[model samples]
Target: MLVVTTACNLDCAYCYEGGGNGQGEMMDLDTALRALDLVAASNQPFHVQLTGGEPLLAGELVFRILEYIRNNNLPATTAIQTNGVLLDHQTARRLHSFGTAVGVSVDGLPAIQEQLRGQGAATWKALAMLDSERVPFSVTTVLSSRNTRDLSTLGMALHSMPAASAIGLDLLVQKGSAAAKIGVQPPDAVTIRSGVTRLLATLDVLNAQRSRPLILRERQTVLKALGRDEARPYCQACTGSSLAVTPRGELYPCTQTLGDARFHLGTLDHPRLSGTALPDGRLPKREECAGCGLQGRCPGDCPSRLHYNGADGAGLVCALYRTICDYCLYKGEIPS
Candidate 1:
């Protein structure tokens, strides 16, 4: 179940939903409840992420929706993706009571963070509140040229947070953000390699100190590093494994396609997808993967992002992904 609202208090440079300054519609509580009902009937133990231009911008609507889901016996793991700019003691307390795990987006330490994510003071306050409330949380940082230099610094910030359970290295996806509109591309192959190498080394240092391991590229990074034989998780966009519903109750496969009318799945209350099969169907045909020896494990790259970027065939990131996969596969992470 995806709840969407086009309201936010911060002007983060990397925001994908295009929400800030209250531009989208606001769904009523009844509509949100109906969506929950549909999810419960699907029999898919899916996560119900409360997302928005900023979900909290809808006032107590988030709490109410969570309460309804729990009370109705719907099976869901509730999560909230917040910039942490608007979080307060009272709000944090209510969210914690609902068992809604929080994932706060922070780019780096104060200097770089303020450049990437606004309302620095508020973000810090929210992190402190989460810590005081003992709320299990993860900090997400978007890597970029402007901030990539701060990977170790950001790691240090997270390492200092005893309340943080994990850190997600969100490599910037150049699409909707000002970065892309202004012609900013993702780091080149050389840069990706150097940045990832730096990130991995820094994480090792932090791990040596007993801090939680940072999660980047998730299964791909982990499996390859450990030399395991596990297949990489299919891209979220391709499988429709995830969906994003807008504030007006419109459904999208993922947040990346939220505003694109073509990707609309269905209304939130109805919670049924419309149109052709989602990109997920592209999987299972190993031979179609274009000479990718790791196709069995990597599936294909994220179809949603590919469609969004107007890319065809293998992607720029695919080459790097295969490199990681091959390194891991031969290294015994996957037990050939």
Candidate 2:
């Protein structure tokens, strides 16, 4: 992942980047190119995710990087993670032309969106623009105490967008503005389980009516883990296969660990692509999870969140995965 810039246009209540206010650094063309070269050196099929406080804030730099990928014929699949407020018609067209996958951060309906992201109408407009331009995109919602009850409503709204292909539920991380704020806390386990249960039922009904099903990112992960012989790491960062490059060319295991000198790998000038030596690089065995029914069936939670929330983090993850896996078993969605 490449954090093109930390300058965000919105002051989201739970922004993990600490509510960026357009006063952060932007990546230079040379640094971005060098980062791409570093990834290419791995000699592996890799995915490049262009993310930021709001990547569209640096529109020119983003387009240039996309152009570089195409012109060089780099062996990489690219995507952009945006807040969707700046995804106007021209931006949507440009993204379509580049054939880059787009993931938009939108918390739920208009009211919830306004409360969390401080922009609702613009996100709706961006969704319309993406649909109009035939840009298939996914929605990522930061599940928090604020919007846990509204998951079903969000699912219905997303079903209306023809270009919407998936919905990814990101449990709120206790960092940034979220940690400083009073009301912005991760939802309790019961709220998550109930909210996700309703969401799963809603999606089931929605998928039955549509020719192309709307994928649930968490459910997909659980399904894959269930089919595997043993549990796999939750994300590429756990195995040290992924790196997040900041605008200043600093590298970390992933975006969530972008700062924190402990996880910092190195700078673009002198790269240190060590595997699993970083603090959160390797997945640690949790004694608390031993002998749990869902132990092996679960892929585990985010290392960054675990590091931040400690024991409470594991409880949240267990609630989420257990709810989804139990729902699937009850519905016979997969063999028990």
Candidate 3:
């Protein structure tokens, strides 16, 4: 993943890298090129997701990378993940020409959104611009303690947004300063199970009603995982699949590992891509899970959440994942 810049215009409470204090921190252009060259040299197909506090914050860098990819005919799929607040009409047009699929962040209506993103309606306007430009985009709603219970309401709201081609629900992993101060974290296991069920049912209604229905990533993900060849539950080990590039050209296993120097993979100029040495602390380590039949289907919980705040909160959500997995495995009740 190319982290163009760590600066974001919005003061979202759950920002993983704190906030715009990282405004000036940007990945050097040469570092970006080197990263791409290394990937292309492998002669393999891959995806380079441009992400940051907001990639659009560094529009020039984003454009340069896209142009380079096209000119070189790199065998890679490129996309950007942005907050959508700065995605103006012209910017949207430029991205469209580059064949970039945008994934924007949108929690809910103004009241709910402002709670985490501060007092602003810029995101709403950006969403409108995306629709006006007919930009192909999707929404990522970060579920927090504040909005978990009302996911069904959020589902209905997203359904009404023509710009949203899908909704990807992300449970907050309290890591950075901004995220830790979000006031409420994710709810307990039982509550999450109930809330997600409601959200899934609401999506079912939308799928039945709309001709080009927005996709439910949660539902789709669960379905795909269940059908996979792995007999055990799978946790997307961040180090194995991808790495996040820092502004200084430093590499880390994932964005969640930012600020923690322990996981540094080395620099782009002197690259050392370590995929196998990541510690178990970065994964679910509950000893009791060893003999459980469900271990293959639902590991413990997200490691990012477990050690985020210098606390072990993974058990809270681990129980939740277990409950949901049980229903899916035994009851045959998929997320949708």
Question: Per-residue lDDT tens digits of candidate 2, residues 190-241?
Answer: 9998999999999999988887898999998777767776776667777778
RMSD after CA superposition, every candidate? 4.1, 2.1, 3.5
User: How should the candidates be ordered by TM-score, best one leading?
Assistant: 2, 3, 1
Q: What lDDT score goes with residue 201 in model 2?
A: 97
Name the candidate, 1 or 3, with the larger TM-score value.
3
Best by lDDT: 2
lDDT of each: 0.64, 0.83, 0.71
Candidate 2 contains a number of clashing pairs equal to 0
Scored by TM-score, the top model is 2
Pairwise lDDT winner, candidates 1 and 2: 2
| Tens digit of per-residue lDDT, candidate 1, span 1-336 | 465577677766756654366466776887787667765777877688887777777757888888887887677888898888778888888888888889888877767667776777678778878888777788877656677555666666666667777766554555567435542334455565565556656766786776455454443454653443445444555545666666677877777677676777777656566552356423334233566555555544455555554442234455345545544545455743
Residue 220's lDDT in candidate 2: 85
User: Residue 76 in model 1: shift from native, Å?
Assistant: 1.1
lDDT of 2: 0.83
| TM-score of model number 1 | 0.82
lDDT score, residue 141, model 2? 91
| TM-score quality measure for candidate 2 | 0.94
